[model samples]
Target: MQSRRSRTSISISQQRMLSHSMTGLSLEQQKMLYYVGVDVGTGSARACIIDSMGNILSLAERPIQRQQLKPNFITQSSQEIWQSVCHCVKSVVRDSGVPSEKIHGIGFDATCSLVVVEEKSNKEVAVGPDFSNTDQNIILWMDHRAIEETAEINATGDKCLKYVGGQMSVEMEIPKIKWLKGHLPDNKFAECKFFDLADYLTFKASGKETRSFCSTACKQGLLPVGVEGSTEGWSRDFFHQIGLDELVEDDYRRIGGSVKNDNKGKNFLSAGEFIGAIDESVAEELGLSNHCVVGSGVIDAYAGWVGTVAARTDVSLPALAKSDREKVGIDRATGRLAAVAGTSTCHIAMSRDPVFVDGVWGPYRDVMANKFWCAEGGQSCTGALLAHVLTTHPAYTELSQLADAASVSKFDYLNSRLESLAHQNKARSVVHLAKHLFFYGDYHGNRSPIADSSMRAAIIGQSMDNSIDDLALMYLGACEFIAQQTRQIVEKMTVSGHNLSTIFMSGGQCRNGLLMRLLADCTGLPIVIPRYIDAAVVFGSALLGAVASESFDKSGAKSAISASRKSSIAGDLSQHNPKNSLAKFGGIGGDDLPSPYTAPSATASTSQIATVGFPFPAPDDVQEEQFDEDEESGSELNFKAQSKWKKDMEDRMKGRSSDNGDTMWNVMYTMTGSGKVVQPCAESHPDRVLLNTKYKIFLDMADTQRKYRQMVDAVE
Candidate 1:
């Protein structure tokens, strides 16, 4: 097979798009200048065309194909992805009736998955044996096939790891590269160039070495730009120490050379820097004018930040903490942390100064659009977990039938069914159904403050009621836990010195009303859903392009007209105040709230709600309060379920760890990496009891991971 240069030829699909008069008169309804933003996500590629006013004129999506070669390993084709992008761009422009010449610039954002190619020809390489097609060389970001490599790299304690929330994981590029060397030493893996998926798209689109600081510094675990001593970029000593010394001497050309001091001074570009116009031949093939500038690309999450807080209608100093004028994504102001939820969810919090948070990734300088430092907390699975919950249940077929009967999608049915349940039980609402169930949500391992890459999920309070309603209740429980996980991250960040009071959210998951409500309820904080929740990330990409192309200026009258800013954005809160529950679990007093890191929880369920916390609900349901009674005081249903879930999780770790096979730690890697064993759950009730019980679970989870990791890397 011959190595082929990127953009050597446009695919037939792209050509078909150009041939059709797709950009018809509707797009020509007005002769307005527009910018296009392209967001390449795990499931699809979306493009949005926005006029100078920042209002979207048209939006379109093209699904990208993914192949799961094996358990815990996923692969994709960059060619397929690029074709999807072109299709979406043309579709949006056509639907909006925007002329090709009116499009000023385009910006791209994508998952931080790794793309591997031949360095010289920019041709895709065969990533693994299960893939027969060499062009399927992009490794999905969620792949965890490099656990052993990740452990080895972490053992070196390289300074770069510090930028990644104090530990490294198999999801990042360094470990993936190490896995490539260890597993396929003689194959294409050994001789390849790597680009975090964002840069890969930029290179494919503009045919230049364009890399954004957001993806390069934030997700790849590189030394963050603007950190005091990181001007030299990659640390050769750390590379040699980890036994991957080959990456050191030749200026680390395979992984990233644009940042190496020797490579034409092509250091990281801010999210808004225009990388130049799209390649002329490619632009023609995709029906775009040669003048359409392509802006530097950003990780999909940072792009979410752009659309949510920095959109055109929004002139307020966005959530950029405090920083200089030149940075992208950075505004003169800051407020809420933004949660971009999809397959995996990331919580992005910005602070004026660097805050060293344990287990959370970042504190990366200039990475948040060159303004405030960034702290990222994430869950490995969110929407994916909920899908598993809905599909695997016995009621799934019935639910689907019901949904089809009602002429709605399954997810939409999920919402309607829950509302029906609330309507059926006059004394209770959806909250009543959720109270009967609980979930751990980390079936794919913990990715935030707990930082365990090997953690499995757990469920409690399941009943023999295999009805669709039962499934709905279980789904509600799963959403609750996902929200709680975010709450845990928020608490951890608050303890580490952030003054966040609200969360601004984007992505597919936010479209689920129950999810947004539950998150607000569990965290006891306001949850702000941007107008275009489903395409906020895509819109954010356009915002970057608009800024890059000078269609949207930050210092313009629109911004200056609304200079006064409030500390928090307001939103609807859940009827139940879960802060009492959070406070109890976090272990702060009911009267005075102290940072959990310094004060710590004393016992379960005793912590106090922050004085400025969730809106106090007019006491509606007393069941949550009733559970606070001693073990001898209630029906023991909730208590028993909670206990059962804990025991199953501990047993899962014990059983999996005892094996000596290659999958000995499969439970940890795929689900979780907990270390301790405790007796069966004890039936108990009380806000204090619940809080203490859950806290113990968190502690055990953390301890389990530490012990297991130590065991794996022992000096045998």
Candidate 2:
């Protein structure tokens, strides 16, 4: 394939002629904007180049090395991971043939693993039991070595724990940090500075220690600046109570800064907010432009949410006027969950208000969107469980041979085998083929709605037969377990206040047709797959890059207003008198919020939005005037009412400075994209009934385990 630059290459004379011909266009219009998104997963680092419209231009991936030092203790070399990142990034840029100068921004997302660096040496520090290997500095997210610390922290019952689903997991940064302090030599622990892997990538790129709200809020337990009834951002008392007062005493320098102390110099940016320009040396190494800015990074799962949550859905509401379609979209978004499935599955759901689901991590403020709260529920082992079941089964070699012979993957062959078994058994569906099999896949422990790391898996109804058919049955059971747990999680979320109606799924799991179908049937929710299934998380990072680009910040309001003016409704309003149309609708005014009618000025900085006591509008009232719509006489009254509401909000915020704040209003441009919808099978009612019965048994299994533990303890 010809490279993009090779195909578009032109001589100086042709360039001059082309430049002269394009003189009528603005600089922004003449240049094609591109962004690079890099995603560091548990097994590989993937990168992609995307146009401004969210289309993937070129992609590259490189494998990352991991070492399992012991059971539940996994480690990786940050140096090696960075090398893989650089390699993938450079490959994407070279393969795409897009000029480095044209790549306006770059963003990164990674597994929420912990990276340890020595403050003095600026080098990797050993995180594994082997102190000699400094290269193994990253504690993989699946590492559960912090189980004791997690239990100790949870025992304190600190008020801060409420924000993190009433208990911190061994997977979170706090417990891991505590584990390091207790286990590592005092001098080594004192010398370390910890970073969530995502923040580490951004810090490496920008040469800045700025942390992302997605990382700090979701993983590090930083109270978002704007949560109601909270004045201080970090809970110093909680930190002290948890026996990690050194962090508080040091003003959180090792992690991030104290949110309460302005002197700490720790900057926390939300997702898509600009961090800084890439470091010159790093830029050269990655083959990117020095001018390219870096965006605030997100945990890989949140990046999955960023990539898929804003997808256009087919649902339309008659009650909402055409002008209120943006409102409708927001409503739809709140009802849709983004299930980023891979080695583990993270179910991310947003709500207009905080929804505190027990065992689910969050009510995290301003992580995904500016005002919306996000809840994350997860299963610690899904993909890994399937892999384990297949790779360990006696008939695994037979299954692999058959799959390879048929020119299909093992999963594909298993899915086909399950379908054939259902047909042979005259079952209602493939789901019925596993009716007698039950798998409680907590092999790595449950991450959410249970928050237990000590839990174990229980498989019932296994046969003595060691055949390919038996292996297929085991795979089906594991898939069913994953889907049923999803249903349990959704139920927990719904009970807690989130009204999830659809599942926007991303990551490698999206390619599993069996799992996808099972997820929909088991959850009874339609699953929407993104355009690039495996690349969705990276694409989301690219969207972040597009948002952070200088062109986006400078021309955002102009583009919004221009697009609004082209709308039939705005056109009709302009027909009466074009010059004063905006004034007529009360759009021409000084406002505290990021509105389409006003361009951001120097006085309005992004930081001001984080100030204590700023009266941000209620979530429902945000961005009502920003989206454009078609004209409809029947909706004129509704538009007028919205205009009145906007004017009221402006009056309320009149004295506030319109300075810098990273708001989602500017993100509208990058949010429009396409996806494939996987609706629930219409004929799966009988399967649904069978699954519902198994789901009841699934719930009972957890309770029975607890009872068994109690009985065993009492005897002791």
Candidate 3:
């Protein structure tokens, strides 16, 4: 199939792209040399136009098209994704009225999906079941078609697999490649070339074949992504074990044998080095200047990390005095975790020393801007799960019609509706709505701490009521579940020596007032939603641009690539396995933890949850320059929600059904709050235990279905 380019309507004046429609007043627009950050998220491509000081001038987005060929098969068009990127870039440039030549540096970030192309024709290679449809060549990062292959690879117990949470996931490229090798026409495997999606975008934009250290190390499952003190070379034993030794044949060119050396990846940029000047033709095509430099890109979540965490450090460092110098570097950078939440949530923390947490993705040496070791934790779904629940619910049509009538998006309408329902229920907010409904967010799978791909999402206390109120409460429950998952990851990290003081968050969920407040309240950790919350990823990519632009003159980038760069020394990494708890991921069985079978103490009623569990103050719809300029508004907002919230959580778990003869996973769905004191807002005490007694029902149902599938497969 000939996939058409994604298009956007805009004014093109004199072959130099003028800006798109600018909304509201600009927050100090500088017509001087600007940087552009392009972020390709799961659903859309967004671009941010920023000045020298990391202040965003305007933003624009173009949606990418995707195809779900089967329940477990997802595919995309590299050409279309690239086209959408181009459209977003052009649109942002047009929207901000920034001239083509004035744009100095541009950086890109994308989901770590796999893109397959035929080098001979420079066209997508057919990789799906429908071989004739070459456009379906890109495998989405979320696709699970390679699960069996991943399991087979895991069975081999290759050493390199240890770096990836000690398991080979269907999401990684290695397993996907094996699946493709076994599924596709044999010749096609040799005929096509593979590129992680981020690398593909950079190649498309700058005509450079160089890959980012982040993409190759973290996503390809080839480089020892987060493991320290190892050669970043392809594992011959692993390929042979998996029966695809061809990958190493003929100079290992298919997967690129050359990699970042222990000292430095000369060709690899440390998240922000300039890769190449934009190609002349592509520059002209997108109305960008030949002077536009492409910064070394990163995986989308890492980009979000930069957008959030770094907003506190790097941008504000230059102004610090000599006395504050010692405090400026490693300690500050390592103290916070970047929580990039969208379709999925990836928790990234950096440390001067490597952290070896089982069931976590990284502790990769110098992965973040080539300075700190990064540890990665993730949830397979968050906003994506919430969307699924809302859209697939019976109330969706009615909800959508009402949302349309109110001239607002269904999400926004639901938010307002949820607040009204809380008022109607005589509660401070609908946070306690979990009393009538509960949701487990692992619908996609558990990505971190537990690293269980077989895990499934569950909901208890569901009813036939299809009213907007019911849907709204269900949405609230889903958000709380996501918050609980964050706490679980945080607990794992905190236990592993990375005590995160603050959480810097970016992505779609940051804007959801309810989720943000719950995250803060539940975790008892302050979440700084950057002023550029909506464009955080784009800004993160832009920071890469800032580091890449020659005028910006990042000596750190040069020194990182210099011969003086140090190789990480190997550490004693004999780490214990993450606990496999059916009831919880956070210290599920330690003496410190409460017994799973134990009942909650006679704590006060949950009336206080409704009191302190209020949403963070509604964000100013348009962020002001004062907040935008201060970048590190590690601006902490605390919801004085503690005791009652904790008691309610305890109640939800106390009466859950056990697996008597079957093994029902005791998924942790809520956080035990921080003992931090906050001014009390309400004191109404109410008994709300919605998930008790029903836990075993959902668990049994899921287990039964799970076994039924296994039995059916065996019969086949």
Candidate 4:
């Protein structure tokens, strides 16, 4: 069979002629630039088309195939995912009625899974346990089959481990690569070329093998050249210690080549930086214009951060000034946390200077934005945990039937049941319904503050109840457990100097009001919901495309390219002082290194480095005048204004109903894509005492589990 590239080939002169014809169009037509964003999540591939002002015009989705060969092992097909992406893009462009030539740029974001392909033919290589199914070339991000390899990497105590919180996670690419190398045949391993899923998507679009800094620095063990006093991008000594020294041969060709010595001329791009035009054959196959450029890609969660962090909010929060709400400059981003909650929850915080937090996955420099360091903490499972709890209950079938009969979602039905229970028991709030129950929600494992993957869930105060009321209580307990864990994570981050005061959330979970309320009340911080919750990640990718297109000058697109180039250049380590580095746990001297099994405690004397080049703007800076006059006119509308608007709208729409009627707030969200802000209950609220008590119990549950583990080990 002939390849798709050969079948859809177009001559170079035809492409040039097509490009020249666009200049003859009317001025208004030339100004109407559009962008496409494709997101490859675990279960599906989604695409969206957005105009210059960030309004999503059309969206589409298609489910991809996944295989579970064994427990804790998940695999996928790269070809099938690519097909889904193409179909979704085609559908969105057709539905939106946008001309192909008017689409100026495209961007991609995907799970940080690993992909293996033949170096010469670019054919898929088998990664399954049987090693015979070549279509299953992708190793999912959630696969825990590399547990032993993770332990081995952590045991080496290499200096590179410090950047990943002094431990390696099985979820990262290195451990997964190690597992493949040890299990696959030597011939198959030698012929393999590895790419992160996001990079793979880029390569599929542009036919360029350029890797992204976001993928290399965060998941793979590549030390960014200028940050952390490193002269070369890849640490050869660390690779040698990890027994994967073959990867260092040929300038690390198996992976993306090293930054300083890339023989293949492959560039490592930052998020939204340009990566050449899309391949002509690929553009034809996907029903796009050949003139469209492809932007560098990012992990899905990082895309969520990009989508939600720079939202134009009405309130002046602790993180950003009123003028800076539309821009995510380094200084303004420090006080905000981007919690991209879905099947799992990833908490991303940025800082002007590197702030090392124990058990967090970063302090990785120049990954998300230029001159900024990102620290990532996460929960291994949140939505999955809730699903497990709800599905395993005896009343689940009855609950589903009732929800269908009422034309409501199961979660909404459960929320109503909990409210009724609260009323019947005369409880202060729904939180008080689970007063006697306590849950430890590490069913998958702890991803932060402990960094232990061997931990399991523990529940107390069970009474063998099998009724719907009992199910509601259990669900409430699980939600509370998620919130309590968030509190612990925030405490860890704040103690290490993050200073987070508000959470900007995006994903499917943001639609769940009960979870949002619990998150705010539990953490005592306000939550900022994005305008588009389920589509935020894909919208973020579209933002990346917009930045690459450079149609809007306010996005700082040119500066981003310059900063990435400067960071990638060799002999540029003057800004990073060796004494201030956290490579040795705050640069402590001697053999006093902490154990590899436990997270190192942050010391009071931890180094604080000054921000280089990008200084914090002054309060009275004149640059604030550069904003559009219309934006500045009504920019002072705070949370109080939003609340009043909501109330007035509710009163106006009273007793009116529609097919889409769920709540007045949701109706408001649909009509105007204006997001909602959820604030914590007052300090004197009736449930405060019970919540505090439950939080204490939540803290103790982890310690109790550790003691149980110790007892079991002692007996053996």
lDDT of 4 by residue, 554-625 (tens): 122122112222211111112222211111111111111122211121111124222122111111211211
Runs off by more than 4 Å, candidate 4: 1-30, 261-266, 314-319, 322-330, 551-674
The predictions' CA RMSDs to the true structure, in order, are 21.3, 13.4, 18.4, 16.9
Q: Mind giving the per-residue lDDT tens digits that candidate 1 earns over 581-633?
A: 21111111112222111111111122222222222221122111112234342
**How high is the CA lDDT of each candidate model?**
0.62, 0.72, 0.61, 0.72
Q: Give candidate 2 misplaced runs (Cα > 4 Å).
A: 1-30, 226-229, 260-266, 313-332, 550-552, 555-672, 682-684
Per-prediction TM-score to the true structure, in the order listed:
0.72, 0.80, 0.71, 0.79
Report lDDT (Cα) of residue 19, candidate 1.
24
Q: How far is candidate 4 from the true structure (C-alpha RMSD, Å)?
A: 16.9
Candidate 3 per-residue C-alpha lDDT over 531-625 given as tens digits, one digit per residue, 9 for 90 to 100 = 45566677778766755653122221221112232222111100111211211111111111222211122111223221111111111221111
Rank order (by TM-score, best first): 2, 4, 1, 3
For each predicted model, how many residue pairs clash, with residues at least 3 apart or on different chains?
31, 8, 9, 0
On a 0 to 1 TM-score scale, where does candidate 1 land against the true structure? 0.72
- lDDT of the structure predicted as candidate 3: 0.61
TM-score of 4: 0.79
